[model samples]
Target: MSEPHAGSCRCGLISAEASRAPFWTSYCHCRDCRKQTGAPVMAFVGFRDEDLTWHGEPRSWRAGGVERRFCGYCGSQIGYSDDRLPGEIYLALGFMDEPERYPPALHAFEARRLPFLHIADDLPRYSGFSVER
Candidate 1:
Protein backbone atom coordinates (compact mmCIF):
# COMPACT_ATOMS: atom_id res chain seq x y z
CA MET A 1 0.00 0.00 0.00
CA SER A 2 1.18 3.53 -0.73
CA GLU A 3 1.87 5.87 2.15
CA PRO A 4 -1.28 7.54 3.40
CA HIS A 5 -1.86 11.29 3.39
CA ALA A 6 -2.14 12.72 6.87
CA GLY A 7 -4.08 15.65 8.44
CA SER A 8 -4.32 17.16 11.86
CA CYS A 9 -6.47 19.57 13.78
CA ARG A 10 -5.32 23.13 14.40
CA CYS A 11 -3.60 22.29 17.66
CA GLY A 12 -2.34 18.92 16.40
CA LEU A 13 -4.33 17.18 19.07
CA ILE A 14 -6.36 15.23 16.55
CA SER A 15 -5.05 13.60 13.38
CA ALA A 16 -6.18 11.22 10.68
CA GLU A 17 -4.87 9.41 7.64
CA ALA A 18 -6.35 8.49 4.30
CA SER A 19 -4.85 5.51 2.48
CA ARG A 20 -6.58 6.29 -0.80
CA ALA A 21 -7.24 9.37 -2.89
CA PRO A 22 -10.45 11.27 -2.33
CA PHE A 23 -13.63 10.10 -4.01
CA TRP A 24 -14.95 13.63 -4.36
CA THR A 25 -14.02 17.20 -3.46
CA SER A 26 -16.26 20.22 -3.15
CA TYR A 27 -17.12 23.43 -1.36
CA CYS A 28 -20.30 23.29 0.72
CA HIS A 29 -22.39 26.35 1.43
CA CYS A 30 -25.16 24.80 3.44
CA ARG A 31 -26.25 26.59 6.56
CA ASP A 32 -25.20 23.60 8.62
CA CYS A 33 -21.74 23.61 7.11
CA ARG A 34 -21.33 27.33 7.56
CA LYS A 35 -22.51 27.22 11.16
CA GLN A 36 -20.14 24.44 12.11
CA THR A 37 -17.13 25.90 10.36
CA GLY A 38 -17.74 29.55 11.24
CA ALA A 39 -17.00 30.35 7.63
CA PRO A 40 -19.06 31.37 4.64
CA VAL A 41 -18.22 28.05 3.02
CA MET A 42 -16.38 24.86 3.85
CA ALA A 43 -14.19 22.78 1.58
CA PHE A 44 -14.37 19.03 1.89
CA VAL A 45 -12.71 15.94 0.48
CA GLY A 46 -14.40 12.60 0.74
CA PHE A 47 -12.94 9.14 1.03
CA ARG A 48 -14.35 5.69 1.52
CA ASP A 49 -14.58 5.13 5.25
CA GLU A 50 -12.41 2.05 5.04
CA ASP A 51 -9.56 4.11 3.64
CA LEU A 52 -9.43 6.41 6.66
CA THR A 53 -7.84 5.98 10.09
CA TRP A 54 -8.07 8.25 13.10
CA HIS A 55 -5.17 8.91 15.45
CA GLY A 56 -6.80 10.79 18.30
CA GLU A 57 -10.06 10.48 20.19
CA PRO A 58 -12.19 13.05 18.42
CA ARG A 59 -15.41 14.27 19.97
CA SER A 60 -18.46 13.61 17.82
CA TRP A 61 -22.15 14.29 17.66
CA ARG A 62 -25.02 13.59 15.34
CA ALA A 63 -27.10 16.42 13.98
CA GLY A 64 -29.64 16.37 11.17
CA GLY A 65 -28.39 12.90 10.22
CA VAL A 66 -24.75 13.97 9.91
CA GLU A 67 -22.17 12.80 12.37
CA ARG A 68 -19.73 15.70 12.97
CA ARG A 69 -16.36 15.06 14.52
CA PHE A 70 -13.67 17.46 15.69
CA CYS A 71 -10.65 17.97 17.85
CA GLY A 72 -11.48 18.16 21.52
CA TYR A 73 -8.52 20.38 22.34
CA CYS A 74 -8.58 23.02 19.62
CA GLY A 75 -12.17 22.77 18.43
CA SER A 76 -11.08 22.52 14.81
CA GLN A 77 -13.65 20.77 12.69
CA ILE A 78 -12.05 17.55 11.49
CA GLY A 79 -14.57 15.58 9.52
CA TYR A 80 -18.13 14.38 9.15
CA SER A 81 -20.26 11.61 7.68
CA ASP A 82 -23.85 11.46 6.63
CA ASP A 83 -26.01 8.40 6.17
CA ARG A 84 -27.27 10.07 3.02
CA LEU A 85 -23.79 9.54 1.60
CA PRO A 86 -22.99 6.06 2.76
CA GLY A 87 -19.42 4.76 3.08
CA GLU A 88 -17.91 8.22 2.72
CA ILE A 89 -15.90 10.03 5.35
CA TYR A 90 -15.50 13.71 4.53
CA LEU A 91 -12.63 15.69 5.99
CA ALA A 92 -12.07 19.43 6.25
CA LEU A 93 -9.94 20.41 3.27
CA GLY A 94 -7.92 22.96 5.24
CA PHE A 95 -6.59 20.22 7.51
CA MET A 96 -4.72 18.48 4.76
CA ASP A 97 -1.01 19.10 4.15
CA GLU A 98 -1.62 19.66 0.46
CA PRO A 99 -5.15 20.98 0.31
CA GLU A 100 -4.48 22.46 -3.11
CA ARG A 101 -4.08 18.92 -4.42
CA TYR A 102 -7.87 18.64 -4.14
CA PRO A 103 -9.45 21.83 -5.32
CA PRO A 104 -13.23 21.79 -5.15
CA ALA A 105 -14.82 20.25 -8.20
CA LEU A 106 -18.14 21.96 -7.55
CA HIS A 107 -20.20 24.00 -5.15
CA ALA A 108 -22.84 22.23 -3.08
CA PHE A 109 -25.90 23.91 -1.55
CA GLU A 110 -25.34 26.96 -3.66
CA ALA A 111 -28.82 28.05 -2.71
CA ARG A 112 -27.55 28.80 0.74
CA ARG A 113 -24.31 30.52 -0.15
CA LEU A 114 -23.80 33.74 1.72
CA PRO A 115 -24.72 36.81 -0.28
CA PHE A 116 -21.44 38.55 0.55
CA LEU A 117 -19.21 35.73 -0.58
CA HIS A 118 -18.42 35.21 -4.22
CA ILE A 119 -16.56 32.26 -5.69
CA ALA A 120 -14.76 33.14 -8.93
CA ASP A 121 -14.40 29.57 -10.17
CA ASP A 122 -16.55 28.27 -12.97
CA LEU A 123 -17.16 24.96 -11.25
CA PRO A 124 -20.63 23.49 -11.45
CA ARG A 125 -23.03 24.71 -8.82
CA TYR A 126 -25.74 22.58 -7.26
CA SER A 127 -28.68 23.78 -5.23
CA GLY A 128 -28.24 20.94 -2.82
CA PHE A 129 -26.05 17.91 -2.37
CA SER A 130 -24.40 16.94 -5.65
CA VAL A 131 -26.17 13.57 -5.52
CA GLU A 132 -29.51 15.33 -5.20
CA ARG A 133 -28.78 17.68 -8.05
Candidate 2:
Protein backbone atom coordinates (compact mmCIF):
# COMPACT_ATOMS: atom_id res chain seq x y z
CA MET A 1 0.00 0.00 0.00
CA SER A 2 1.17 3.52 -0.72
CA GLU A 3 1.82 5.87 2.17
CA PRO A 4 -0.33 8.89 2.75
CA HIS A 5 1.32 12.25 2.23
CA ALA A 6 0.14 15.68 3.30
CA GLY A 7 1.52 19.22 3.26
CA SER A 8 0.53 22.85 3.43
CA CYS A 9 1.75 26.30 2.51
CA ARG A 10 3.97 28.31 4.82
CA CYS A 11 0.97 30.23 6.13
CA GLY A 12 -1.23 27.13 6.24
CA LEU A 13 -3.77 28.85 3.97
CA ILE A 14 -3.26 26.20 1.33
CA SER A 15 -2.97 22.48 1.91
CA ALA A 16 -3.02 19.23 -0.02
CA GLU A 17 -3.23 15.49 0.44
CA ALA A 18 -2.09 12.62 -1.72
CA SER A 19 -3.00 9.02 -0.93
CA ARG A 20 -0.58 7.34 -3.29
CA ALA A 21 3.13 7.28 -3.91
CA PRO A 22 4.64 9.76 -6.28
CA PHE A 23 4.93 8.68 -9.91
CA TRP A 24 8.45 10.11 -10.13
CA THR A 25 10.79 12.48 -8.36
CA SER A 26 13.56 14.56 -9.87
CA TYR A 27 15.86 17.52 -9.44
CA CYS A 28 15.59 20.16 -12.14
CA HIS A 29 18.55 22.40 -12.89
CA CYS A 30 17.05 24.38 -15.72
CA ARG A 31 17.72 28.10 -15.61
CA ASP A 32 14.05 28.79 -15.09
CA CYS A 33 13.91 26.46 -12.10
CA ARG A 34 17.08 27.91 -10.61
CA LYS A 35 15.58 31.36 -10.84
CA GLN A 36 12.16 30.36 -9.58
CA THR A 37 13.51 28.48 -6.59
CA GLY A 38 16.56 30.63 -5.98
CA ALA A 39 18.46 27.44 -5.49
CA PRO A 40 20.88 25.27 -7.39
CA VAL A 41 18.06 23.02 -8.47
CA MET A 42 14.38 22.49 -7.82
CA ALA A 43 13.19 19.12 -6.64
CA PHE A 44 9.78 17.86 -7.67
CA VAL A 45 7.56 14.85 -7.35
CA GLY A 46 5.00 13.95 -10.00
CA PHE A 47 1.51 12.76 -9.20
CA ARG A 48 -1.80 12.29 -10.89
CA ASP A 49 -3.57 15.64 -10.73
CA GLU A 50 -6.83 14.00 -9.72
CA ASP A 51 -5.12 12.41 -6.72
CA LEU A 52 -4.41 15.79 -5.17
CA THR A 53 -6.94 17.86 -3.27
CA TRP A 54 -6.17 21.46 -2.39
CA HIS A 55 -7.71 23.47 0.44
CA GLY A 56 -8.19 26.44 -1.84
CA GLU A 57 -7.32 27.87 -5.20
CA PRO A 58 -3.73 29.03 -5.47
CA ARG A 59 -2.28 31.86 -7.50
CA SER A 60 -0.82 30.67 -10.80
CA TRP A 61 1.58 31.96 -13.40
CA ARG A 62 2.59 30.72 -16.81
CA ALA A 63 6.21 30.18 -17.69
CA GLY A 64 7.52 28.15 -20.61
CA GLY A 65 4.03 26.79 -21.17
CA VAL A 66 3.71 25.42 -17.64
CA GLU A 67 1.33 26.89 -15.08
CA ARG A 68 3.10 27.33 -11.72
CA ARG A 69 0.87 27.51 -8.67
CA PHE A 70 1.67 28.92 -5.25
CA CYS A 71 0.03 29.98 -2.04
CA GLY A 72 -1.60 33.38 -2.45
CA TYR A 73 -0.79 34.37 1.10
CA CYS A 74 2.76 33.10 1.63
CA GLY A 75 3.88 32.92 -1.99
CA SER A 76 5.21 29.46 -1.36
CA GLN A 77 5.43 27.51 -4.60
CA ILE A 78 3.31 24.40 -4.48
CA GLY A 79 3.06 22.78 -7.84
CA TYR A 80 2.87 23.17 -11.60
CA SER A 81 0.68 22.09 -14.52
CA ASP A 82 1.44 21.47 -18.14
CA ASP A 83 -1.21 20.81 -20.76
CA ARG A 84 1.16 18.51 -22.61
CA LEU A 85 1.27 16.22 -19.61
CA PRO A 86 -2.42 15.78 -19.04
CA GLY A 87 -3.50 14.39 -15.68
CA GLU A 88 -0.07 14.96 -14.14
CA ILE A 89 0.85 17.52 -11.51
CA TYR A 90 4.37 18.27 -10.34
CA LEU A 91 4.69 19.30 -6.73
CA ALA A 92 7.66 21.09 -5.29
CA LEU A 93 9.47 18.47 -3.22
CA GLY A 94 10.67 20.99 -0.68
CA PHE A 95 7.11 21.88 0.23
CA MET A 96 6.44 18.42 1.57
CA ASP A 97 6.15 18.21 5.32
CA GLU A 98 8.82 15.51 5.30
CA PRO A 99 10.81 16.27 2.21
CA GLU A 100 13.54 13.78 3.13
CA ARG A 101 11.08 11.00 2.38
CA TYR A 102 11.26 11.81 -1.31
CA PRO A 103 14.80 12.12 -2.53
CA PRO A 104 15.24 12.90 -6.20
CA ALA A 105 16.09 9.86 -8.27
CA LEU A 106 17.32 11.79 -11.25
CA HIS A 107 18.79 15.15 -12.19
CA ALA A 108 17.58 17.05 -15.23
CA PHE A 109 19.03 19.95 -17.26
CA GLU A 110 22.58 19.22 -16.19
CA ALA A 111 23.93 21.50 -18.88
CA ARG A 112 22.49 24.49 -17.13
CA ARG A 113 23.29 23.38 -13.60
CA LEU A 114 25.39 25.78 -11.61
CA PRO A 115 29.12 25.18 -11.51
CA PHE A 116 29.37 25.20 -7.73
CA LEU A 117 26.43 22.93 -7.13
CA HIS A 118 27.63 19.37 -6.88
CA ILE A 119 25.17 16.53 -6.69
CA ALA A 120 25.95 13.18 -5.20
CA ASP A 121 27.65 10.68 -7.53
CA ASP A 122 24.79 8.18 -7.52
CA LEU A 123 21.68 9.66 -9.16
CA PRO A 124 21.32 9.58 -12.94
CA ARG A 125 21.98 12.87 -14.69
CA TYR A 126 20.53 14.09 -17.97
CA SER A 127 20.81 17.23 -20.07
CA GLY A 128 17.07 17.47 -20.04
CA PHE A 129 14.06 15.32 -19.23
CA SER A 130 14.72 11.59 -19.44
CA VAL A 131 12.09 11.39 -22.18
CA GLU A 132 14.39 13.51 -24.31
CA ARG A 133 17.52 11.50 -23.48
* Overall local distance difference test of candidate 2: 0.83
lDDT string, candidate 1, 18-57, tens digits = 8888889999999888988898999999889898887889
Scored against the true structure, residue 39 in model 2 reaches a CA lDDT of 78
Tens digit of per-residue lDDT, candidate 2, span 1-133: 3677877789989888887888889999988777777777899988888888778788999976789888989999887877778888889997788889998888888888889988766888898865331
Whole-structure CA lDDT of model 1: 0.88
RMSD in angstroms, all models?
1.6, 1.7
For candidate 2, the per-residue lDDT at 133 reads 13
Instruction: Give the clashing residue pairs of candidate 1, or none.
Output: none
- Model 1 lDDT-worst window of ten: 1-10
Per-residue error for 34 in candidate 2, Å, reads: 1.1
Each prediction's whole-model lDDT (CA): 0.88, 0.83
Off by over 4 Å in 2: 131-133
